[model samples]
Target: MSEYDKVRVGRLVLKGEKLKTKKRKHKKQGRDEEGTTVRDEDASAHGGWWKTVRIEEITGSIGIEFGNQTYVKALDNGLFTLGAPHSEGEGPAPEEILTAIKVNDTKIALKSGYGKYLRVGPDGVVTGRSDAVGAMEQWEPVFQDGKLALLGCNGCFMSVAQDDDSVVAVSKTAGKDEIMQIRSSTARENENVKELPAEEQGSLAQVEENYVRKFQKFQDKKLRINTQSRSGLQKAREEGNLHEILLDRRSKMKSDRYCK
Candidate 1:
């Protein structure tokens, strides 16, 4: 099955399309080896919900979000924390990844990367790291259609509502706004974050510095005498590309010593 990930708060959300396979009218006809693709209406009649996706707490963090003095971590610890784990950016705390295991009860155990389970109590408080499994260790998966939420044994829904700032809390009411869009580490191309490579970055910075300096020294006093430079500048302004600003004349910035 194709791996799927849900969109997050700060991430761009795009419309997703799926191929719906239609049912063969004749029972004798075997299913196509290559599968088939049909219109959206045909797929709906076949009772297709596509692949079921749920809110799953992972057991490991693929990577880290670096910062100067602080970092949010806890992927493999069976508990997730959002704060500066280190006083300095040197030694980063271990990330505990989580995976959900559906035990005998309706509750599912969110197994941590270290084999521990994340559980909530009647007070809607979450904790982990126990050798034995109990009712308190199980979490009931709550779903608002595609939006996934968790209703712990505490009778409260897991939420990061603005109502509280104390790490993980389950007291949040089951509202659409409270649903957290936990994103995976799957690499995505974001235009806004698409930075130039190191070489390009340095080149761009240097070019800009050169441009500002050149403009600062610019004047129209010699416009008639230096028609070539003027025309080059004009062309540069019109084209709005490299040459428009970086004139072909390499010695454009040289001092005018007026040598015979």
Candidate 2:
């Protein structure tokens, strides 16, 4: 079957005790090589929720918000199996709740009590499990109809959500350090976009320093000229030669003795 075959894409929710699928029928077609009709159970039989929408992650986690409440989780690692071993005396272990469920031989999280977290779909078969996820903090999954959804969390950093054909692990720890690593590594790539080589970027600083040095040279020369002009005026006044000097220049006269 094609990757998208029998896939129920999108979110499903419970509104006032009624479950609703968020997707409209986009298309319809005859059965494929297999005689599987496009029934809700067909999707559930393939490990997908018959009622819940299947949200695929392209870049980040798929988020869903309804009626001012939001649900979020990783779409990748899903509830794989049931009746697996569970962690004993680990949770809100009231006689009402189950402690934990065994996931891949590890007792992580699970729903307890009437097994309501063991959600069922149109066929009344459990399609996925809902439990209090760890390290994910406020992140939780809600199962309505046959689909499961992620709910809100208070403090999470650049949360990572994904979906493959199998396995889903939702947590703040997901995609951790990936964003920082990608950003830092891209700096070098951005630097390479310049016409000059990497070393030439430093040349800009050196060019600025050279301009400063040139400005200082011009300033020093100006200061020397001002000082000389002042000294010449003082000497002319003391010697009573100011008029003589002015008349000499007007009459095109030359006196090498006064040149000093």
Candidate 3:
């Protein structure tokens, strides 16, 4: 039900605001043959008219389902992954304005709101460019139960993995278990517990060992106290001294109640 859900492909969106342009004083402009001889007046002025070049769906559901919030933002620098946008009529959010175009039969490409292509590095890092065309920008849509999980590119699934810093990472993997619901684009990592590195795992093991030692010490102390009480009772029984046993029990009770 958010405003971004209404956005579709080929729709022209307004940016911030409009601005007036000054007349060119000099006209001796040199450019390539295919380049423009004169800049378009409409393009020069800021009328906030940004056309929706592409619409890439992060999830398979048309409605706001589990993963419907996932969106890729096309910024001036590059294509950044984003979630559902709240902005309405004013302007299109970067993530709400992307063109998911089919590059070929089995591949697809996500172009930014301003025509930049989303690309991924071999190391699973993602970036966007205005003028680069490579296989790194292409992805194969992975389906689960006839629903779209996400696009798979290179050797990884084009998914978002958030790190400890809360920054969303452009990661590629088969999937992530950090998140239970598929609604979150970034992996919801549990910050309270951090999975230690291989070298640091021994520290966790050492902690466990310390707990075991403390528990064993408590058990040994409890056994020794019980044995001492049994010996006291046996001594009282041998002498058939009921009064002494009762006195001893009362003294022990008082000592236990007052002891630190």
1 against 2, candidate with superior TM-score: 1
Q: For candidate 1, lDDT tens digit of each residue in 1-260? A: 33444533444545794555678786646434443333334213222212123434321232212222222345444455544434321333444234545574455665545666666645555656765577767666565667655666667666532443223545657675345433223222331353432222234435444444443343553321222424445455456665434433323544222211
The numbered model that scores best in lDDT is: 1
Worst 10 residues of 2 by lDDT: 178-187
Score each candidate by Cα lDDT.
0.44, 0.29, 0.42
List runs of model 1 lying over 4 Å from the truth: 1-79, 83-96, 121-123, 161-166, 181-260
Please give, for residues 4-59, the per-residue lDDT of candidate 2 as tens digits. 88797756666666665478776546333333222334323322212223221111
TM-score for each predicted model, relative to the true structure: 0.36, 0.16, 0.36
Any runs in candidate 2 off by more than 4 Å, and if so which?
Answer: 1-37, 40-51, 54-111, 114-170, 173-260
Model 3 per-residue lDDT tens digits across residues 118-138: 666655556667365577677
lDDT of 1: 0.44
Model 1 residue 138 distance off true place after TM-score fit, in angstroms = 0.9
Report the number of clashing residue pairs per model. Answer: 12, 14, 4
